[model samples]
Target: MTLAVPSSAVAVPSLRVLPLRPGALLLELVGLEETLSLYDAFQQSPVAGVLEIVPAARTLMIAYDPLSLDQAELLQAVAARLGKKRSVGVTETVDIPVHYDGEDIADVAELLGCSTSEVVRRHTEAEYTVAFTGFAPGFAYLSAPGAELAVPRRKSPRTVVPAGSVGLAGEFSGVYPKASPGGWQLIGRTPLAMFDLARDPATLLRPGLRVRFHDIARSSMHAVEKTAVVAKPRAGVPSDIGNGIEILSSGLPVLMQDLGRAHMAAQGVSLSGALDHGNFKLANRIVGNRPGTPALEIAPAGFSFKAIGRGVVAFTGAPAATSVTSANGDVASVDFNTPIALDDGDVVALQSPLSGTRSYLAMRGGFVVEPVLGSVATDTLAQIGAVALGAGTQLAVNSENVKKPVLPGEQPAFAMPKADEIVTLDIYLGPRTDWFTNEAVESFLSQSWRVTPQSSRVGIRLSGEPLERLDRNELPSEATLRGALQVPASGQPVLFLSDHPLTGGYPVIANVAAHHLDLAGQIPVGAHIRFNALNAFTHIDFVASDPQ
Candidate 1:
């Protein structure tokens, strides 16, 4: 299966699969450098269900959907062809203009021991190849910026870094694309929208694309908010059964979501959408939203909506102490345990919940949201959706509404998080679980790990013993996802959540199961935890996912 790289055509590794239980092992060619980068895989063998790929300086880390093909069947297919890796591609050049006027520009220049202009010179001089995309929507991690601009990350990360801000640290350089908390040294800012939800592709930069910075005039910077409304939704019933409630008094933090945005991982876009996929589905089933249909996923203080249409919406996740009022002024409290119907402008509002952190609002008919990248899932990470939920975001109603689920008010049967055991965690042996000492490993499985204050949609930093690694001191970046409990060389074990970076320099000791995924969603800060043996939970075979 070892074929020489053909200059005209990108090399493709023969499809070699590996078995690993509900998942498959994918052995494909990856480019490492300009002459041997693995960026060619995404361009040539563009197959469906490609989850995420993290291309570093010398290797490409891949994580695929396991439910489609079991791990056992996949390993056997890939074993023979796992020989000398061939080059996937060279690189494509793309010049980017920068302002070199970030708040940390001078500080970064001082660290590099040169004039601020020299910092910009060395940066803008040599071309930077995109390594990978993750952390946020369209956040491209460019390859090494040569040695002159090499430096460590800031000791204390800033609380907020503005969008389009250019940064450099160690071997990587990237544009912020969006405002967020980060530790990279800022060097400049860009005028272009690195990540745009309204854009056809969303993210323009991809791994292997060569990039350079060009300074632009400050006055040229302006907002790129082209609101393209796809009016008149396709003819179909919005959902099943009863009349749906209309949004009456929405208090910020309301969003329409589905499974999420995928395929754009290389562009650094996040798979943003519902916090709890299970509840999102359950609520939809109650009101009868088809898979991939748009449902409202709201926060603790949920918004109030009035029902002008006939349909029921179920609040499935974290018990939002919700109350709904009839048009006749009959106010009644509705619990998350059941589904309720609203008849024409009936107002519904979710007061703060005592136990749960988030809530789901599923209409019998899915929201009439415009689809982007084959989904209406709003990616807060990449910022894709009909629009960000705000005081003025409006949703259109469909004329030929769809049928609701089997039952509108009928409560669906399901599994929920245990009210007790604040310190218990389900586990599965990980790819690098053997790297740690038996004691360190034992400590990891037995000790109570506390949720640190530094927790968010991105990741939850835990306060626990340093799980010492006896083998190599560092690990090359690889595919990280939800419930990925990764241990960096620093000894702290971080539980990566929904918005965790696609690739990270850490060792994942275990991955939480899909059934238990909800438990990790709103793990209150300061809560304690300990790991349970992987065998403690039964393996519910996951079926292959179908595109909606």
Candidate 2:
């Protein structure tokens, strides 16, 4: 539905507010410029519980803590903010050198019915503004008024597009920060690195930044490419003594993670952390470490670590068989939620979990690692943070500070599903439920869907009856979140996880409830999942989401 813009600066534009999740709201606005203007205003004076305010093509996503402020109060404040006009601040201009030798340059020229050189001329002459950042870290969508070089995305997305590859789709242009899957029409390539985690400000082109492309000779392109190097790990003063465990063998994509990078969705970063928060916190507390401490997120199993110095440690999430072998050859099995006293040269081994997909291991003082963007969490989708764990890795820990007494009765175990179990999750209908047919929505809730093996930290793909759409119009890319049930052209649904992309161009029928988000993350491959729709607010039978 379209709304008219206000004629007076003090008049508010008609806005449509939709519940994104329990504590988040998706505000559909007039357009990009208005979205950015409101985004700037909110940044200048943010609400108390507002954690992240993400601006998309035509919507603004506000994430908040429900405990700090109620949704009604927050919506009132937003309405008041929209009542007044806000100015977009002045932005910086960045001239980028481009090489007109992309694989699809000639194809794009033919599609536009122009010579390749003229296509290059049109691209170079236009000045583009960074409308928003999404898809991947450092990938900025460039937009300009009265754009003349618009093109559709490729029918088939390439499995991998090289870093610095410039592409265009619809009314926007972007350069891929790293090698990843994409559907944009490749027109040229740039040598400038778009994102560097080692850099103080990771993204070179931020939102509202003006950018212009200039063509360079193929010979000079080599020099420009040489300037783009991976950011080196920054050296830092050790905050703790270099005492910790040495990895004998890291089982199945182990990673060091804390509560991931939050409040940075505008920068194309996802809130990726531990899959199961309940288990992560329980493990930390068991070892006398504070919550948010760096811990080893162990994927289903075969991990081994040797203690360099004696320390107290505990494991949680996904019940698994753990064994501890002392330096004297005394081996004993350990249980979950129980702190294990490790002596020097003690080796700990973890087998595959009988249930669940991942586990958490925490030490008394927490693991010490170089943090990127104030987090040590590894976002597999964005490829941010420390590299995946492997053999021959040596990590340090902080000083064994205040050790809290653990009550015997306080040892709590997290629930995990048995092998090939069916998991039922509650969901709340959209932001975009109207996009799908009524039958499709019914199929989504009633049908039994199996988690495909293609699932990962990015999202869980489910194969079932195709969900037919009510409208065939293309959806503009918008901000996405964990548990978003996005359906693409294939009609299959993909439930997003912790490391989901910041934005997507698919229609989301429903979002898994906030309370069951962590449970959604634990679903293993081949597991059957049934969606039970619930009333959005009243927690009663879900007859209709919004009566109005």
Candidate 3:
């Protein structure tokens, strides 16, 4: 069923509502002005059930708790705020010194039919406002009103764009925060750090701020050297100095994870926590640690650690071959999902998982690690929070987050799918489902997609029949969520995981149901998946009427 807007409310830049999921909705607007205006209104007076509002170039994604509000109520609340005056707040202007000696400077000038000096002049003269932050932490998309410095992205993106490189693409300009792959047209490089965790806010730019670029000489650039800053554990937390765990060998990088940072999507931060949320909580519960207590999220296989002092620990998630060695060199196999007492000289080792991909280890207290932005979860893409664990890494534990005593006996374990197994996951179609043809949607539900080995905490990249698109135009980047099946131009859909990016330009066909997300995360690489649609595709259209 489609929700239609009132005919009397038709006006310029009409509003349309699209169902993103059961708990989320995407509001389609005309441009940045309409998007930001509504964003400011929601910020000034927030709705009751609205958990987050992520603004983009032409859309606003709103996520809420289904228990607190329904879709019809949310639509009415949003309609009431339309055409409301935006309250202006004090805006800060940041000045960045740039060296205009980029490799693309000449190319950009030639494309604009102007001289290199004119290109530099045009960039430095116009004032740009921070439209939205995405792609990466501290990477803010800047918009310049009435400026003619627009350019297209390169045909092929560079594998490694230098950090702090100023670039322009389409109608926006931005800086690369930490040197990842990019396709923007580089015009210059900046000495100022775009993102620093040591700072109070971490990111240098935010929404509604003004930015100015100044041309600098080559000789002046030598004074400022780019350096990487690591986030340390917050001060004032009590620690057990002598009692700790020391890593002997880690086949893959083990990371500390909790519930993850919330309400930070406005800064391009994703909700990066343990991939298996159910097991993460169960591990902490068995170890008597409170919810949100930091724990070790180990990858499938070869991990060994030694106890510096007496403690209790529990292993959960994927089933693995685990054993413990005593000080006198006696070794004994151990069972999982149960608490094990450890001595000072005891060494515990884990082999490759028999089924799943990730395992969780929880201590009686919790891992003593410094958190970045109130979360211990490491965001691999954004490079935020705790550092990855490797050989020789030592972690302290304390009772600060303990709530109860350790539980006795073993917890029943569920069967995890093996590599050759085929699992079925439920999905809800929407938001961008109309972009695909009916045949494509049917094929998506019928065909079996293999979980490629290229998958990671960021997303589960699938290999299957390419789902053809009905509309192949470039989609403006909009907010994304965990479990979203984002279909790129390659026709393959990437199921976003816990560490997925906040926004993307690809169209999402469906979203995995929330109840089955934990199971989806545990599917081993090479396993096949069949999608079951819970409902048919429905388009929701909403136009604001006179509030009086």
Candidate 4:
């Protein structure tokens, strides 16, 4: 069926284009319908240099290669595609059997001024359209026209929302793909596995699809549970290991990371990779491994491993004390950013880094871990890709990517910031800078925000003077980038890292400069960060060209 432009929408809705970074732009539309229409148009006619397009509630984030396309040309290309009549392909209709027995059903009923049964009736009766997928893999936001079931989110979000949970927030309803932290008001649950890597499509729901909820008894829910398919583990290392590493101890689970799954934002997958990209690359280069070769991303807590056969290895990133012990009991200290030769039965151990949060260990041939969705990156937030490394995990090595000679005297791009130091990062104001008050914006740039212990690969949580905001309205979820300084209602800003959710609802006052993203990722907990704005906030105005 053709997706008709809503009667309320003008022929040419002005687009508010804002710079997200050096190579990305966020285009704000009037509403979801207009956003979807523009997305469809882009799909029909691809734009040059636009690597990926992540569509959200009312905006589209375009990530491009700056060398291939300039901002002005990209803006003109987007303007030319605007206001075009496009057809949406026919999508499948999926029926989910839901048991209307959530913990918040009664509270939702009271808020809507309706009985619990009425709440279930209205929800089951409405046919919803999947507007977009985000927050997590396979988690789709469903929208129904003229639906009066709108409700506000919970006052305080739950620490863990169970998988298969059906929830509603604002004007949309969705099912939780997996158990994770959430703030939505849940009304029910479904037995269907919303996301299963074993399945061909992986995700049960996607944008433009039709969804219907069927009320079912709790006992009958088991019948549909079989549809939930669990992913099988990849092929294990051969018993007769010729060359590999045996993890003797992993204090904090180590993750296999490469450059991450790119061009996958449309499916709600984050660009998760090594937090410190420069260090990750340096480690790989030192060991003579090809770029993007899978390597071990170690936390500051430290880990130890044993070599099964001869190979070359290198450690980079954090300034950690490392040493290798041979079977003869001879111990030799290792230096950061230097190649180390590993012999059979050699035990290598790394102590907690004196500075920074993560380190990288790269083997000459790269670890033989299987890739998920075309990458070996493990997204902690999305809970996908390679599994975390633990004690007793044996990783095989292959010489498929050993292309260059090991470089022994390589140096890191920058020094890791110590916990007591105050690191200054360059930022460009934008997409939602106006959401905060002038004082808040000024304070954000001038204040020294302390990085709290609540930091992770997902983001670096900062605590400082609460940034005052002028707009208290709930911002619809939009595409987020690494190093986005997102301010929530509490006035605290979270600097998103590699594993940040693809879409976020908080307002992003600024984004760290591209050159400084790796540095931002290495900031230690208890450290202080002072932001320096490269340019003041400015809006981009573009007039739509004739569709004809």
Candidate 5:
């Protein structure tokens, strides 16, 4: 006889719903099993405007479009789904071959007060299921309930953990798909390719999949290893497109970006796109290209490009002084926000911006490149999308068919942000504020924090008096978003940026307000920032009629 799983009606009451961002909500559930059950139910009957449903250890992050669905209706739909009786589906079991020798093998065994042999036996004996995938593509979080291998993460995380290293921490086991910073205790190493973009599914593991580890002799580790599947060549990027720009010299960092990829977050892809959206859109509009067209996100200063064909070019953001020199030696100064005509072989040079950190350059037609997962945005952290621009890189532009733009008589002007200025950002506290002491919360709001040089597209490290946490427990991995003010063990806060990680273990005491996201992007290094809390009720868009 087939065994029947219990209904989730009793479990539904245990959920704590919290509003996250503009159109997202966080549903804190009891266990990984219930989280997976709700995930399955939502997939069966998805609500309108619900783009992606991401599951974590004990939370479900639901991303929706506010224009199509109201926040209250979305909550009602999800609550109804959880109220129904649903059966957990059959799970696929995968066996991973691992060599027993690792750097932390003896350390882990000593901490658990057991022999190294017993540690390996316990790990292999238990059946672990994949709880979720995050941090990086194909990085799955595995858990074995009612197991005896619970342990604490290292006091300090390694700067770089080698790929294929098997690790364990706090009832969880995972293999690093790529080399990255991690704190999990190393138990062994696996030669299996956990993540390969060339494969049909890309990721080797997914939520709800069963995993088992088998012991393999060190001698056979290389013999049994499988090579990554070869990827098919992508189309759309031609070697010698007629209307294209050849890079003579580029600034320190230049990347191709669009509006970013939002629907692919469940696959561990971040929404890495243009940092300053207001300037990116204005640049495209001035050049008569589509608003979501891929453009060059040039860093402040030292960007020069030669036009291969006659096209209209416009630059916005940072108010950089520009100069255009034609092949005939005729030179003209270009004004910001106004479209400039570029002849064949005309060279354009942009100096350092008087203010601001990033600028956008868009042509009459958008840049044509092979898109990965429906976006041209380059994510430096996740290493997705187009490669970074270099001095000799050739870029193809779709200037052959330019669309006529409808413009107002007066050009729209945007003010640039001044460097070394104190900027106040609106934030919403909670989701983890109870973990901090009252004094810590006050320090977070009143103190003026300086942006550290270590800040990047992933996150901004703030320097200030460390906020004290009342609780000393290790935070479980949970869904994180851009603008999350995550506080680590050292009490320092990290403000997440566009290419931030999908999930993190640090407690996020506050999130930057939705309206201030673009402004947050332009915050330069050495700038001072103060976060002010906004009323929580203002974030939700309540519908006039509630769903029955």
Candidate 6:
């Protein structure tokens, strides 16, 4: 009934990997024989933007952020050094302790047709090396799930696999690093924290680092118990920074965000922030602030804030009805579009969105919160920023006696994108477009695609003709970027969003441009969409117009 295969036994086809764009994509030869060689290659002449060299069972996965360079350019640099020889660093390895007890542990034993102890023996037989860092922040897929023990992920996924879980799926064995929904066949758990926000390097270890996990007594689970504590460090930030905003009433899912953490992809940190960036910045502008300044990305049923004095504020993208009811119940419909003045005790709240799917509410003198790794972006998937702005969390208020901006700029007005009945998204043909049949690509380009209900900040699921893969490519998990078009085994093509994982095993067909982000953001569940392809010259021409 199951289609899992043993790693060692799987017939090899000589690793038929090909260069997609070679300019931005990187291919690393991993597996114990030569992967570790890249260590010296990196040390002798380190390449800029060469994020990290990960080592795993005879291979390595190289990771990078394409934002630093276009996909085509990044891959060329990698191909240029295809045959270079290097040495694995003779560095000391860290010993991590793990408890072998997971729901799927027994299932894995049966698949291997061996005793559970034998499974553990094979797993710990050799000192495993981290091939590359990916999946999520702090999640490292190590190379040691013994060929026999290697198995595919569960047919159905677990919604919340806890942090520290040790799992085996395919030839890969990894620790969850953080609590998340996963389908990896879990075999055990580790006490060692794979990802610690308070800890330096954020991700304790990276690719190529030699790691040997020791099995500890189950009783030690409590001895090495993990405690999650999020607190502001006692460092000297500006004394004027107040304890953030006081939430009178949150209209909907309102949370704080920032530009996000970059350069951590090799260590598995995802860029998590407001889903609709256009609206995010527009909200910042409404508050008399530069775009990209941290702002409250409010959704429909916008949140209400009562500031102590008049503060700069702005709103934009996904235009929604907004109102500020004074302490005396004087309602300001704000037809004039400026961030209405708010003195002490003034209360403001937004009505349900009239057109767009989301709204942004930004305040001038950006909310001063404890910056983590020089960023306030919350890795919602990793549970990393000031406790995800729960009901009672106070926003940090910058108290430098800020002077309010002169009469707010003429309220920049915009309407919601055209959706509901039919949606049109312009796209570039693709990175892995060749993996699919030409007919499938045609179907993707011309057919009507509907946004599925399972969409989230991570990715948008679509209901359409399954874009079938022409050939089964042994995809080496590579770094995935925002707007990546991925057609998984499920046949549906998913458009990854802001919170997507740093790398994935899927074949990304194409990437959505930044300018079209706002348009894609407003496509709600059940929305029907049509895809259109554009050239580089045409892309420039399309953005020539302000509206998408």
lDDT of all the models against the reference?
0.62, 0.80, 0.85, 0.86, 0.79, 0.64
Lowest lDDT block of 10, candidate 4: 1-10
Candidate 6 local lDDT, 197-221, one digit each (tens): 6788778778667788778888888
Against the hidden true structure, what lDDT does model 6 obtain?
0.64
> Which of 4 and 5 is the better model by TM-score?
4
Model 5 worst lDDT window (10 residues): 537-546
Error of 4 at 476 (Å): 1.0
Clashing pairs in 3: 233-370
Q: Taking the tens digit of each residue's C-alpha lDDT, what string does model 3 give over 71-179?
A: 8888788776766656777779999899998879898999899999999999999899888889998889998977799888898999999998999888898998888
lDDT of 5 by residue, 159-222 (tens): 9888889999887899988888999899998988887766656778887789999998888776
* Highest TM-score model number: 3
lDDT of 1 by residue, 133-158 (tens): 76665777787545477777788989
| Cα displacement (Å) at residue 5, model 4 | 18
For model 2 the local lDDT of residue 301 reads 68
Error of 2 at 110 (Å): 3.3
**Tens-digit lDDT track of model 4 for 1-548:** 11122222347666788878889999988888888888888888898898989888989999999999998788768766777765756768999999999989999999999999999999999999888889998899999877678999999999989888999899899999888899899999898988877765678887778999999998876532323332122344555546778889978989889999887775778889899999999999998988799898999887999998888899999988899999999999989899999999999999999998899999888888767777888888887877788888888878655779999899999999999999999999997999888999989989999999988999999999999888998899999999998998889999999999999999999999999999999999989999999987887755444433
lDDT score for candidate 3 against the true structure: 0.85
RMSD for all candidates, in order, please.
Answer: 7.6, 4.4, 2.6, 3.9, 5.2, 8.5
> What is the per-residue lDDT of model 2 for residues 111-155, given as tens digits with 9 covering 90 to 100?
889988988898999999888899988889998767577888899
Output the better candidate (1/6) by lDDT: 6
Model with the higher lDDT, candidate 3 or 4 = 4
**What would the C-alpha RMSD of candidate 3 be, to one decimal place?**
2.6
Report lDDT (Cα) of residue 437, candidate 1. 79
How far is 445's C-alpha from truth in model 4 (Å)? 1.1
